[model samples]
Target: MSPRRRRTEEFTSYYGRPVLKEPTWEALDIAGYIFAGGLAGASSILAAGAQHTGRHRLERAAKLTALTAISASVVALVHDLGRPERFVNMLRVAKPTSPMSVGSWILSVYGPLAGASAAANVLGIFPRAGKAAGIGAGITGSAVATYTAVLVSDTAVPAWHDAHDVMPFVFAGSAAASAGGVAAALAPLAEGGPARRMAIAGAAVETAMSLTMERSGKLSAETFHQGRAGTLLRLSKGFTVGGAVGLALGGRSSRLVSTLSGLSVAAGSALLRFGVFEAGRASTRDPKYVVVPQRERLEQQGRGASDRQGAAAGADSMG
Candidate 1:
């Protein structure tokens, strides 16, 4: 007679469902908002630099891009709200600890300044005032690029929370890359040198930060390379590398090359946002992510207690 086989213990959550709350954010609305907000924020910085440096083509493109991207980002955010009116309520109180509240304030401050800056340039309204507004936008723009990372990382999402230290840098670099891509695509060839340089620098930072994130978490970081998230992140890395290489090849003369490079970087930035969002969802979906960490913590507590008890017993014997 054949011996009966024993099965390994299986880990399960309630009805085999996630023990954590899956993010309620819709992919297109939230993901698109993240990409556009990043673009707007970084473009504002580029616009300010171009304005200061007297690069007319780059300044014009960056200013207009910032305005357009921020407007689109607002629409995406409103679209994601179940009750759009609740967005207005978000501004009623300030919560320093709350990223969402801080983000709302940042947008409010950045939006009008960005709009005024672009409008002043387009309509020749108030150059001095517009420049001042543009500067303000530039200052606030950095927060816009980074605050979203804090928003996601502050949550229970394992992938995001675990990578909190690097998330801001990752998002900031991606934002800069997207903005640089826009400038590269829209500005004249001679004026696009800074844009190309910015693209390369941003890509390098983003790639390095992302790699750091993946390597830092060991098993937990597997969320980045497991399924759909893995596929998108890998593709984002490929596009980022390709875009950077293209920018290097294009130099300052090839408009077509610049355009392709810009497009690739923009695509890569968007894919990275999508990848991170999807990774968070993946982390929540699997029980192991939730269970394993907790189990380890409990084991650690047990060992700590045992060590304390042993030390106390030894002290008592000595006494």
Candidate 2:
């Protein structure tokens, strides 16, 4: 009789449930907060640069945009927490190791600076103080734009945690692209050169980093390219690339083209944020994303230990 063949057991969780609990964040609230924060942060930086360059219209538009976006982001955050006091309560203690704590502090500081800058610009008062506030906002705005990536990556979600190395860059690029697009669409063509350049560069970086992340060859990476997340990401890539091309080819010659292209890029950035959020949520529903990586790590450790033991045994025998 032939030897009985051993069956390979498939990985399964207790009661076929997910190994990790999915995040309870609402898609609209959390993803919108992410998009708005990035837009606000990048707009502040662009506004500061435009001011120094004598692009008054662009600077004013960017400042207002930053203020509005940040305000919306705060509202979304508060809504997600289910109570306004919950957000304020986060300020009761400062925990440097906690991303949520740090993010709350960042929002607190950035919000006032952004508001001050926008108010001074619109009212044409406190010119020097407004400039200072704009500068401060620009500095903190960077942290605001990229901190969400850190916050998400710090979680136990396989998709977000595994891509920590590239997530910040992706978020930063998306922020710049969206900010630049909005500024370019709103500002006069004569003053939009810088905005156009920023949009193009940001789109390139966003696309490259996203591709690098998807190609990481980990089981978690598959979450990005399957189901609803995949569809959203694919559409985002198309819009971003198409918008950049349109800006490069016709942005200088026509206002309509520039506006359309800028809007496209902004839309793409928003979609990307939603897609990333969805991917993390989807990863938590699958046990393989959590189990396979842990198993692989243990197997590697086992092989290394065995090799070390054999080497030690050989050395003792020779002695």
Candidate 3:
């Protein structure tokens, strides 16, 4: 007789149907928006910093990148909506609990500030006013960097919803790296020092957060390591690692190496966003990803209830 072997566990779901509706968001549009918004947000901060420090070339490049990326992000978002007219109506109301509403408002405030900063550079007018707008963009930049995390985690998707605590940091770090990469690529070699440092720091943070999420996310983490999403995430990790190493080796001495590193980091950031989006979609499609976690939650609640009842019985007997 053959020796008995352990079988992998499988979870069943009601009627073999997905427990949650997959996001209606198109991968190209929504993922692009997420990546571009992050890059724009972080670049705005870099622009503001450069402007204050009187680094004209860096300021202009960062500001232009911010404006261009944000504008593209807005376009992607509107296109994803299908009913483009409703995009305008999004501004009509504000709901604190609604991440989407909050994100729209953040963009409204951020987009104009970024555009004004870029325009100020182009028109060579309102120097002080432009500085103020750049500062405002920098301030609102946090929202632009991390609000997408709120947007994704607020959903029913198990993988995304479970990793809410780390998602914002992941996105934030990725955004900063992407912006830094762009700055490194576009700014003069002499002015690229800060960008290089930012890229290195951001890459470190993003990699750490991703590793933590994968280790601590329980079953939800499985989505990040399976099929297409898995492939993309693995690629992102490799690119990020390679970029970080290149930056470290090149330091401030090699502009060519810095530029190449910047490209790698930017590509990694894009892949990270796309991979995350695909993972969330995969989580929704698989009934086990949804059902298993919920079943665990119910079991935990049952245990708590039983313990409470047992405590009550003991208290009555003592009385």
Candidate 4:
């Protein structure tokens, strides 16, 4: 556990393990969580951001999106649990190393915060929590967005593990874009300036990050370029592009255009989750995805390496 010490025998990743042929999780399952978590956080941030800039309509729409996303995410998380009725069993023990336990705790906190914020938006309740609760919601939202990366990475899943850093940003941007889209659709454009900006910005970030990761040699985005994964990725790209273009025009004048545009963003966001999730699983299904790059890393590590120094250097290389 010493940070300074070096140990070559320590397991950096699972490659030669005998317990499993290949490791993977269902794409839909994984992406569903990504979508929910992202939506929740994005909504909260949009809501708080609106309130800070003094936009009540924007704030309300954002909170509603957050509330709805939190609700669906809760359901999806539980549904993914093998025993839905015993999903609470996760809380029986708390372990920091276990992302689920940590995420569960985060969700527990965020649920209430999101709920309170939404209620405040309605009933003309306490507006003070808008910022306070939003801050908490955003923190938890990020966790929700990125924890899926940790979850998938911790497993023997090749695609997920390799793209850990990039994945978080992808989910974050996608979520923000999705929530922003919803705000755009539900609110009038004139009143939806903040949401419009957030949606555009978030979508741009998501598209850019995804493209970079797809091109990165280390992350090996090629695994995601084929079959069902490819289809989903393409769908996400199309929707995102369409949404962004629509927003570029003065969508404010035409309610139909604004609504459709927002819908496209939301759709793209959801597809992003599905695509990444499937890609990870698909990578897991193919032993090559794991054995190839991992062996490449180990081979690199076997030759002149320091855990800290190497990681930092790798970070720069990837950047």
Best by TM-score: 2
Q: Which residue pairs overlap in candidate 2's backbone?
A: none
How would you encode candidate 1's per-residue C-alpha lDDT over 168-279 as one tens digit per residue? 9999999999999879989998888888888889999989999899788544688898898999999999998899899888747688989999889888999999999899
User: In model 1, how many backbone clashes occur?
Assistant: 0
Candidate 2: minimum summed lDDT over ten consecutive residues — where? Answer: 1-10
- Which residue pairs in model 3 clash with each other? none
User: Model 2, range 1-319, lDDT digits (tens) per residue?
Assistant: 3111121136777898999999999999999999999999999999999988889999999999999999999999999999999999999999999999999999999999999999999999999999999999999999999999999999999999999999999999999999998988998999999899988998999999999998888779988999999999999999999999999999989999999999888999999999999999999998888887797789899999999999999999999
TM-scores of all candidate predictions against the true structure: 0.94, 0.96, 0.95, 0.82
**lDDT (C-alpha, whole model) for all candidates:** 0.89, 0.93, 0.88, 0.76
Candidate 3 residue lDDT tens string, 4-56 = 11111555567778878888889989999999999999999898889888889
RMSD of 3: 2.9
> Candidate 4's residue-wise lDDT over 54-142, tens digit each?
78788888888888888887776666675676668877888998987887788888899888878876877576765677667766766
- Who is ahead in TM-score, 1 or 3? 3
Two-way TM-score contest, 3 vs 4, winner: 3
Better of 2 and 3 by lDDT: 2
The Cα error of candidate 1 at residue 71, in Å, is 0.9
> Mind sharing the TM-score for model 1?
0.94
